[model samples]
Target: MDDEVRELNLTIDLCLRIGEVLLSSGAGAADVTATMQSVAHHLGLRRPDTDVTFTGLSMSYQRSPEEPPIVLLRQVKQRDIDYDILTRVDHLVRDVLAGRLDLFLARSQMATIVSVPRSRRRWAITLGWGVMCAAVAFFLGGNVVVAGTAFLAAAAIDRLQLLMSRRRLPTFYLQVAGGFVATLFAVGVASTDLPADPSLVVTANIIMLLAGIGFMGAIQDALTGFYVTSGARIIEAMMATAGIIAGVSGGLSVGALFGVSVGRFDPGRMLDVEGLAIVVVGSAVAAAAFAFSSYAPRRSLAPIALIASGATAIHALVIAQDIGRTWAAGLAAFFVGLVAYAVAGRVRVPPLVVAVSAIVPLLPGLSIYRGLSLLADGGSGTSMGLLAMITAASVAIALASGVILGEYVAQPLKKEARRLEDRLAGPRLVGPLRAKGRPR
Candidate 1:
């Protein structure tokens, strides 16, 4: 009985650790719970129940009908999206399910997986963030001067965010600080006689800020009936956005005091395509750079870049036909999800990682920034500001839901394939192959 209890505890511990890593790395709640249950069952535990949410996970296991159940819970406090970690845990689960990894070895590997040491060099990460923001400016039709300003401002913001994080500042304040950092740069540049579009700098940096939030995950949770977790994530996104608004507003106020004028942006030229080839190519580079910011593996960058460029091309094509921006974005993101599913297999990465990274270029950062800019200017166009905000929200939900629908269409067969791999006794591609003449 003592040995059995110890084994049960170890199994539960492994499941909870895996669940924590998956959830933190932005895996959907359903996937986390299902994966945990599958792992527990494959490890010889009977009738495991797993509950997943935005913040934490709880799992229980029973050995026999007459025996009392062992319940275990883990509260996940830190949530940073690291696709590399998610992929590792995902592969580990498959290996365990294939009976290649035993319980004892699994526990040790789980510890290493959860450690999550950053593999990419620090300078590389900073360069990635800077280039990504600059590439976004180029994609948005900014000139050389505007892209340069965006690159510098984004680099500074990334460094500031790192410092704030080291000081253990709240994320809300960090968002505010980041917004202020970018706006301050924009206003300072505008105050000078530099021949640059300062507005483009703000727009690019805003997109970077918006890109880091899990708008897609939030909408996915809501649509899938995980209301509580969805609500939490929605509120968090909103607050982070609000922080950016507040910070930008404050910076603009200071600029007004210094006699600097931040003019309203003209929306007519936002999607112009006179030089669209540059935009499309830059979108690919920007998407890959953003993925690196989240610690995605180097091998996955090429596929992610291709997927993002395709989505951008579709979005630009649809918008050229006079389709609504919201609808165009949705269509493009749906295609991204669908293509990611097929390409992920070839690239040996999960579809969600590719889809999320690919869709980064299409997020409604410009719309959100435009709305906030309007509101900061004495609230004269309040109705129009509200409309822009609504449009931004619509685009966000559309992007997320489109991806979810595409995954839903692609996943049934994939799940069946995984199950078949689990049941097979022969050598398989994903796990360690059976030794020749050793078993069966």
Candidate 2:
């Protein structure tokens, strides 16, 4: 009985680990069942030798060779399942763990349910990204210190405001004030000129923020077959683009009162690899800090370092090649998802932790920065150099979108692996199904 208990505990542990991995890899019930059976055999646990039946989440054993099979029509607790429920559970777990989740609501809803370590790490990651944004602003030729402070401050403040909204500022006011606060850093600190022209830095900041939101929403919605949602997200993106115009127009108009002029952006200046590496370190730190802010698990961060840096390098190379990274991203994400699934067969860490982390390097941060900046700068994006910004933004969106779509396709199979694990822990009939001299 003690041995049985130990085996039972191992089985549950294995189930959880496998489930987490399969869910991230986008596996379905079959994958879960298969993964479970494999784990059980390896752990030397009692498992059904015959085929298992799965109704999405629950599972029950079929007749087998051992003793007469129990004619139990019991609902599989963790065994049988609905694909939708499983997927939802997987997503909730994955996003929340990675610090990519929108945690303000989660924290409000489940403050009692969270651990301290998880929460702190998410916060740390968020602040770290703020630093990265600062680094990126410098590369865009903003005064480095000013850009750095502005980026970090804006991110930190926004996160803090979001956390403290219980004090009751209207969202509109909040956004407006948030906009003021965030943009102030760009204008006051970065000394980035607003030119009484279009595309002032403030306008640029608002637009970029909106675009990032829209881009992420669109990708997620589209992948989930939420075409309406995707359409809405795209529309929001467009609206944000318009907002960029408005903000820049307003700032530029204000600047015009001073008879000041806007300047052209020259992309010819580049960051060397060494400098870019430093930037990546900042990006990873930012992501990790953001993760902690979101209340994600502390243990989940090391993967971010590996995945983000590698992704950044690949992204840099892709940019240098002037090749389309959209399709490339899709292909890359697909393979990553698929291979991660395979790896879960052995090691049961959810791929989402690493997959998302690894790909953070490829996010469309720069495109967002440039497009909004162009809108703020106004006039023809031509001549004074908005074209390049527009193009870079386009490419960034495509890459981000492609990565999202690819990951969507891969999440289902991952769930299947988890279902398999749950289905295996049941009674069987007659003789154990003979394997090819191997445990089934």
Instruction: Give each model's whole-structure lDDT.
Output: 0.77, 0.41
Task: Name the top lDDT candidate.
Answer: 1
Write down the worst ten-residue block by lDDT for model 1: 426-435
Q: Estimate each model's TM-score.
A: 0.91, 0.53
Estimate, for each residue in 1-440, the C-alpha lDDT of model 2 and write its tens digit: 47654445434443444344342223333334444454444344346342322212322233246634332222332211122233233444344344454333323323333221322343554565465445444433455454555466557555755664556653334444545455444444334443221112342234224422335435544543445535644664555454444444454444446554333333323334546665456445544433333333445555545444555555445545655545444444444444433342233244433444344434443444445456555688533336545554565466445444444454335554333222222110001111111244
lDDT of 1 by residue, 34-143 (tens): 56767777777755776778888888876678988889889987755677777787788878988889999998887887675767777778888889999988888778
lDDT of 2 at 199: 17
Q: Candidate 1: lDDT of 143?
A: 82
lDDT, residue 367, model 1? 83
Off by over 4 Å in 1: 412-440
